[model samples]
Target: MQKEIQIAQLITALQKGDVTAFDQLYFEYAPLLYNRIFKLIKSPEIVEEILQEVFLKVWNMRAQLEVDRGLKTLLCRIADNLAIDHFRKASRDRALQEELWTSSVGFYLHTEESIFDKEKQRILNEAIQLLSPKRKEILTLCNIENKSYKEVASMLGISANTVSNLLVSAMKDIKNYIHSKYEGA
Candidate 1:
């Protein structure tokens, strides 16, 4: 209750252009926002970029801040939208997609509770490995590599329909493998 009161006070001060109040709010909420973004983006660099953008937006739109809507809600919606935009951009840019995937593993180490995450990653890796080579390649290209159906079809010299079919089959295989592994647990 007291924290809520303090947050409301800070928001009111921030509306009046108080830099100290803004700093206090940022300090209190940045970690929570950062963690939320990292979970969605899985890339430290992009997460940091989005975190800064979230605050910049808050500051730029300070006049519109509504304490009733809650600052955390506003920050989260901004971060989620930015993360979705990043994915959309990445889908069109092969280089960015590759960079994000390559750097993802490093970011997991930054979190203390990554042991369970690592195990899940291992299981997913195993499931992918169990797929046929061609199916595995298609899944990696279309999903992990963030390639469009047309681009992947062109690269593989296969029809878009074939690519789609293989992708669906591969996904089912992965799903079944994961389900079987965890069914009894």
Candidate 2:
């Protein structure tokens, strides 16, 4: 009963912005609060940090202090809430980091495949370039542009049979060129 009266006086003094009373409150309650917080969070560093934050919150909100209830209860509640918040934030950060790592790995695989495809295209283009101009034009129109033999023959002023023969020869030459180059490598 006597201790309660002293604490009530401290609370009233604190509401009026008495620094000495606030110091007394800290000296009296901080250790108990620290132990309570440490039980929830096993790190000494985190416990110390949370203890300071709890006291800071109390000091900031001293004007609303309710002397009728236990001040220790209020302090413990604040410390517990802050510790839970810290754990929630840490969980969210860990999940976000894992998501980023997965995305980067997927991007790396896509990039590697894209590079390989570009190299193969370069090699095929080189082999096509080695053809005679007329053969290259015929093959490009028929295969690359998806034109029919008749369409290519009409565009190039040749017979459809001539276009077909030229395409067959062009395909054979391209296949031989690719096989020779890659086989040697």
How well does candidate 1 score on lDDT at residue 37?
93
lDDT of 2 by residue, 6-54 (tens): 9999999999999999999999998899889888899999999999999
What lDDT score belongs to each candidate, Candidate 1 first? 0.91, 0.93
> lDDT tens string, model 1, 146-177?
99999999999999999999999999999999
> Which lDDT value does model 1 have at 89?
84
Best by the TM-score measure = 2
- TM agreement with the true structure for every prediction: 0.50, 0.85
TM-score of model 2 (CA atoms): 0.85
Every model: Cα RMSD to truth: 23.5, 2.3
lDDT of 1: 0.91
Clashes of 1: 0
RMSD (CA, Å), candidate 1 to true, equals: 23.5
> Which segments of candidate 2 are over 4 A away from where they belong?
172-185
